[model samples]
Target: MQSQPVLLTAGPRHELPVTWQLSGHARRLVSVAVAGLLIAVITRRPEFVGLAAPALLLLLPGRGRQPDHLGIEIATPAGQVTEGSQAAVGVRISGQGAGQVRLRLHPGNWISLAGESPGEDGWFNFRFVPGRWGARQLGTLEVVIFDRWRLAACRVLTSLPPVICYPEPARLGSLVVLSKLPARLGEHTSRRPGEGVEFAGVREFVPGDRQRRINWPATTRRGTLQLNTFTAERAQTTVILMDISVDVGAAGRSSADLAVRAAAGTAAAYLAARDRVGLISYGKHLRWIAPAAGRRQAERISYLIAAGAGPPYPLEMLGSLAGDILPPGALVIVFSPLLTLRLIESLRALRERGFAAVVVDVLTAQPGTGHGRYRATADLARRIWRMEQEAIRFSLREIGIPVVHWDGQSALDEPLAPFTRRQVVSR
Candidate 1:
């Protein structure tokens, strides 16, 4: 694999006075002064020439040029992490031919090297705590260097590799009661369809039953009886549908971030339960990855989410869906802030296609408007928007689709329980 490019920054440096020789203004001023001085001496006006020459010299044009250089190397963390874990990052900077190079970092999260002079080689070590499970681009590093005289400048750009932060698997005790599901779904059984390790019942021998499942002892116990027991085991396919529309902007936070967290959490949960998981991101553009199982799929999805919001690629929902963006019979869970009409229509269409669709509404409660004419109007507009959102929710339910409203303020399970309960009953 090709190595990442190393970035270099040079601080301001003192160059030889040759920089003055390159100035046209300086040469012109010197020539004019020389001619005036010669005329003054020939005319026998030494005192008058002395005053004029010094003033003329002051008007001479001259400029100074300083040299500066800078270099930066950054080390990023590895993929994957446990809840409450932290990742370490290292940044090194060196200056050449430059006076003290001052640095400014964007995104503010990165800490600077301690006790190091701005112009000298220094090392900065810092840690980032990825609190929630999901994929994330830690942030950007903005480096600025200046010359000793603070005149000339340059810049560099670099993108850190994506990181996958998996959710801590739900503990057994915390898992919703799967009691409604047949006990067979819980145990390991033969790889055959509808048979799991959890005993379901015994029936006359079937052609597909493994000889190991043949209850020979039971056969002898019951004269002339040959039978096999079966259990329940099936793999589910889960599709995470995320909304990247601009309308989700109502909530002070970007809808994209919440959508990523929800998608990541749900995907991780389903994967842990041995289900096939896929992802589809809808905005101005459609991003789709087919259903697959295992760690790599999770990594792929996380990387996409970490890249953050981009201009939506223009495309119709049906066109994308028909093009294999989502598989038939996949349980499609949408994480959106309920911003646009297009998103609502898309969800309705997905349900019409017979997909088990769920919507996790990421709600953001706006702060109360302060006293002002403009504030009053804004508050009224917010009320209208909320009403519209409720109507959308009602419309979705009318079409037999379940909606889960989620706000980052609370635990995810709070909103999830109701929807999951309804799902069991609907099944």
Candidate 2:
């Protein structure tokens, strides 16, 4: 692999000076010499002095050579990659040193390295695969150079730059149809009749009815002018609202992670259908991307999902979203754990604003009581929490919103399958 000209930074690398130290082989030989000399003097034996003579001669620094300058460059894979994919990293060491160069890599979280050993030409090439999404560190790397006589060596250590990994999208066979669709060209069939390929029904032709749309069979049977009508193919604006306020469950299977994965999948599916899709992430702060239709929009939403982290603040309600944040008549699909009361109020507010919504409950785990003196208190709290969660679901249903549960074990589209037939309506 050709090495790029970027240098690795341990920290403030330019400001610090490189230092050299005795190699392990040299240190061991010196220790042996010292011990042998001390034992010979204590036992008054001249044979011990002979044993230390070879060690002392080998430790002589006359033949040791030091490089005038040492440098390192690493070439990492450019651009963003999806999770569970492999990328190559190249390490190149250069300088004037008549010695053996060695490289060592320490893998970091979510990253695994392969073929860590260097080649005969002293270039360390490694292939790494990221296991999870988000910005993750590649690892810490160390390069060691030993002198020709193996007396002294110099070591350079630095950390590799972080790589951005996008989550692997889940498979979604179909999307939930919205109650209302925007007046724009798209792939979905709308209830409104207009110029489209799918035939809706036949109606009596009026004065301005086009001749090409006239239904010959219906016109002959009715003995009057008749024309075929078709449903208008219009796109609907879909906004994916992610409630990242609180995350539950284990690391990869956390509610926040599942929400992100669902967001990516849903965005991809809608974008493929030529529907305008947007994203709204509400935690301590509100972040949103305006609705847009294209492959580039899918990438933008994926990047945001991977990098966005909601900040913490005091609990408060998100009363209503502005028109720009959520376009008029847009279908709002919320991915949340439903743990915060403030978020529940926001869903209610969405209904009041005349927006249709579907909520996918991403909470995978429930609270449990452990065996202890305070088990009674713990059990009571657990029951109350469960009751509160149930109440939230029931309240959403009463307000004309559908709450579907996803445990992360089933396909994301499974919970959403019901909405495909029954559209989410605003009351």
Candidate 3:
């Protein structure tokens, strides 16, 4: 990894001279000074003394001493938290004597901050819930200092620091059943005999056979040497394809969140099986990690899944990435809302090329239905749309693509168990 650049802040050698500016109180004071002078000179009124006295009193307070020694710094621990988890952040005000500090925090769009402003002390602590994944940004913090009279004030916003948020995969037990795994050096048993725990059969002891494997009972019955054989355990390659073409479902949140969470859970489960896992984020931009086995590969895949997708592009481009981007013989599991035609065509293209493709349908029902006037027409249109969707799903299943509809909160074991059993039996 490349080294990160250091940031230069305004402190110590890079410190700036303390400065103060006229507040809104100064503006009001000027109006009062003008009115007092106008009343005395124009009307020769003695009552102007009261107005002039108050203006002088307010202006005199500012002249004596204005607080300028104020600086803001943010103190946060260097660590990580999962999405939807809350993290405590602190903002400390340094070099006081600047009257009462009224702090207002803005923790950006990625985090949901829930806490009051600063108390009597100069410290501000808040619990913020992380909504987006990967390198969460804590927004700008604004502090407005009020003088003793609450009239004059100074407003300053502290700069945001570097904060990285890591993606947290869902907790899945040993119930996640995947498709039939290909033959490789791994945990799953292979058809042919090799070195494994499962008993295969017995054969005449060869020169390379271990003596411990010479089945004594069988050798005694046949009066010959025989060696036990075990099936070789092999792992398969699984690739997660995330389709982020269009985000149109909920009001406050988009469908991308559900898609990402599902992808993360699936990746974690397959990697736990000691299989080679890879990832490909398809949308306006294409990001992919090739298949590999190890702890680092799993972490890399998880990071890419949570690293928010790029802007939307034309969907036609995705159909062209058959053999060029992804390697052959890797099972492709796509998580998508299936809102566009180009996305459908892209999946079809992948299957046409002989890749074992599966689609996790993340698209749920629309929130609200139609109103009074266009009610009948809207209902008819919706019925037709649903019918078309059913046909599309059936077509995919017929072509050997398992279309799994994900319940946002349930375990995926039930849906995947059939797929796993079917593939294993076929193999």
Per-candidate total of colliding backbone pairs: 24, 0, 2
Could you tell me which 10 consecutive residues in candidate 3 have the lowest summed lDDT? 6-15
- Tens-place lDDT per residue, model 2, 161-213, is 77778887777878887756778998888888988899999999999889999
The segments of candidate 1 whose C-alpha lies over 4 angstroms from its true place after superposition are 1-71, 78-88, 94-122, 126-193, 205-228, 247-254, 308-313, 318-320, 366-383, 419-427
Better of 1 and 2 by TM-score: 2
TM-score of model 3 relative to the true fold? 0.77
lDDT tens digits by residue: candidate 3, 156-182: 766566455655454444422234446
The lDDT values for all models are 0.57, 0.79, 0.68
Give lDDT for model 3.
Answer: 0.68
Please give the lDDT score at residue 388 for candidate 2: 90
What order do candidates take by TM-score, descending?
Answer: 2, 3, 1
At residue 420, give the lDDT of candidate 1.
Answer: 49
Residue 229 of model 3, lDDT score: 85
Question: Quick one: best TM-score, which candidate?
Answer: 2
Best by lDDT: 2
Cα deviation at 410, candidate 2, in Å, is 2.3
Ranking 1 against 3 by TM-score, winner = 3
For model 1, residues 90-129, the per-residue Cα lDDT tens digits are 5665543554434443432322222212222465544555
